[model samples]
Target: MDTGGGMNEHWQGVAEGLRDDTALLLAVQAEYRRLYERCFRDDPAVNHRLPVITHAFRRLGRWRVFLLLTPWMLARLLVPDEPPDIEIPADWRPAARRGAPYTMIGPAFSLELLTGRQKAHLNYSTAIGHYFLHPLVLAMAPFPTPEAVFGAWNDVIAARNANLEKMRRQNPQQEEISRREFFSGGFRK
Candidate 1:
C-alpha cells in the first residue's frame, strides 16, 4: 500500500528502472515519439493531460495502466482515428496497415519480446512497460508534427517491407508479423 509520499518514490523508482533498463528506455523512446505524432501533435491539450497522466502513471502499476489506456482506446474507436484528408493517387497501394487498439507493433514487442533475460534483470513486464513506462516517456518527451509522424511511419514500413522481400530467407530468431498483417483489420493466426 502507498502512503502520501509514494509519488516522489514512484518517480524515483521509475528513474532508477530507466537507468538500469537500456532496452526498455529505448523502446519507450520510440513509442513516445510515435504516439506523440499520431495522437498528441495537433492537440495542445496533451500538454494539460500530461501532468495528470504522469501522476497516475507514477501512482499506479501495470494493471492500472490498462485502466487508463482502455478508455482512451474506446474513445478512439468511437471517434475513429482517420488519417487527415489528403489528395492521393487513386491507385496508391499502401505498404503497411494502420494500427489498432491492441496491435503488438508499437510497444508490445519491445516490452514482451522473449529475449531470455533473467527475471531479476528484466526491467518491466509487458503490462507495465506498454501501459505505464511508454506513456510516461511520451509525457516527458517532445514529438514532431502529426504529418511528420505519419510520413516516418510510411517510410519505415516501405523500407522494411522492401528489405524483407529482398532478404526472403526467414530467421526464426527475429520472426515478426508485418505491419500490413497487423493493421489488416482481420484475424491473425
Candidate 2:
C-alpha cells in the first residue's frame, strides 16, 4: 500500500520500466500518435487534459500494469518485467458499499477512437499497447505538445528496429542454411 510518501517514486519506477520496454514503447507510440493527430488535436481542452492525464498516469503505474498484456509468444519483450507493485491511484472511486443512495462518480476522461467509419484499424496487439499503455508514457514524459510524443518515441523505435532487423540475419554462431543431401521429400539421393 502506498502511504503517499512514495507516490512520486512509484511513478518514477514505472517511467523507467516504460523506457526499458523498447518493443512496448515502439508499438504503442506509433498508433497513439496517429490517433492523437487525427482525432484529439482539435479539442479545445486538450491542453488542460494533459495535466490530468499526467496525474492519472502516475497513479496508473506508468503503464507497467497494462504492459503485461504483451503477447507471450510473439512480442518477446526485450526487457521483460514483472509488473511493478504499486497502489491504485487515489482517484479511482468505487461504488458505495452495499447501501448508498448516491455514489460519487469517478474521474472520467472521454477519449474517442476507431470511430467505425475507417477502413484502417489497429491490430489486437497494437490496440492493447495503445489503449492500455500509451497514456501513462505520454503523461510521465516531458512532451510539451501531443505531437512531440511521436517524434521522441519514433526516433527510438526506428533506431532499435533497424538494429534488431540486422541482428535477425547475422547469426553469431556463424551458421548457414546449406543444401541437404538425403532430406528430400520422398526421394533420397
Candidate 3:
C-alpha cells in the first residue's frame, strides 16, 4: 500500500527532531550537574538527592529519545515510506462482492506488518525504556514555572540517584535475582 510522498519526509523530520531533543536533554542534564556542583555543596539533603535526579533525568531522556527515534529506523527497513500502491482489478467492485468488501489496509507504522510475537517484543522494549525514562524527566521538571526549572530538575535527579544507589547496595541478592529474571526473558514479562 502506498503511504504517499509525505511519509518519507515526515519520518525524516521525526528522526531529526528526536536527535535534537536528545541533545537538548543531555545539555540540560549537564547544566543541572554544573549548577548542583556550584551551588549545593554543603547541604546534606541536596547531596543526598543528586544521584536520584541524574538517574531520573537520564532515564526519561533516554526513553523519549528512543521513542522519537525508533519509528524512523523501522520506517527505513519495513515500510520504506514509498511503497508501491496496490492496484485493484478493473472488474472488482465492492458492491457486487458476496462477502465483506475487500479491505486494503496500508501501513500506519512499521510494526503493523510484524507478527504478533514481534510486535509484542517491540512494544515490551518500548514500554521498559519509557518506564525508565519518564520518571527522570518528571523528576527534573520544574512544573508551573520558568524560574525554578533547573532547581526542580536537579532535585529530582539527586533524589532518584540517591534512592537507586541505596537500593543497589541494600539488595545485592535481590538485584542478582532481578538481573537473572530480566535477562531470562528479555524483560518481556
Candidate 4:
C-alpha cells in the first residue's frame, strides 16, 4: 500500500521532484521484482534466486541487442532503397518452372522467410517471430533495461544527494564539531 505519496517533515527538505518521478523509479524497481517473481514465484528458493534470475534477464537483453539486432540492422543494408515489390499479374507464374535454372529457384526459396506481416521494433522486439514464435531472439523491455539501472541511477539518487550536499554546504557550523563528536572523544566538560 506504499503509494509514495505525501512526505512527512523529514522529507520536507528534499528538492523538487518530477511528476511521479519517485513512483516511476519505484516502478522500475518493481518491474525487476516482477521479473524475479516470473521465474521464482512458486519456487522454494524464491528468495535465494532473485539475483540470479535478474542477472539472467539482463544477459538475455544484452545478447538480443548485440547478437540479433546489431546484425539484422547490418544485413538490412543489403536491401536496396526501392519501393515495394510490384504485384504479379493473375496469369503470371513464378520463376521456378519445371527443370528451371538454379538461379530462378532462389526467388522461390526467399518467400519462406519474408511474410511482411511483422510489427516488432527496437522497443519490444523479436528477431524472427512473435511471442510464441520467437525461436531465436526476443526482448521485452517494459521498464528501463535492467542493466542500465546499474550505471544510470542518477534519476533515482541524484536529487536526494543534491539536497544533502546543499545542507552540508549551507550549514555555517559544519566546520565546528558537534557535541556528539566532542563527547565521543571523551573530552571533559
lDDT of each: 0.29, 0.31, 0.31, 0.26
Q: On TM-score, who's better, 1 or 3?
A: 3
Model with the higher TM-score, candidate 3 or 4:
3
Candidate with more favorable, higher lDDT: 1 or 2: 2
Tens digits of per-residue lDDT for model 2 on 1-189?
121234323221222324544544554555345445655567553443332112111222232322211111001111113222233233221112212221112222232322221111111221222112222132323556434544555687799998987876686442332323224433443
Best by TM-score: 3
- List runs of model 4 lying over 4 Å from the truth: 1-142, 179-189
Q: On residues 111-141, what C-alpha lDDT tens digit does candidate 3 reach at each position? A: 2232221121111011011011111232322
Candidate 1 segments exceeding 4 Å error: 1-110, 113-144, 169-189
Instruction: List TM-scores for all candidates, in order.
Output: 0.22, 0.24, 0.28, 0.23
- What root-mean-square deviation over C-alphas does model 4 reach? 25.5
Q: How far is 139's C-alpha from truth in model 4 (Å)?
A: 20
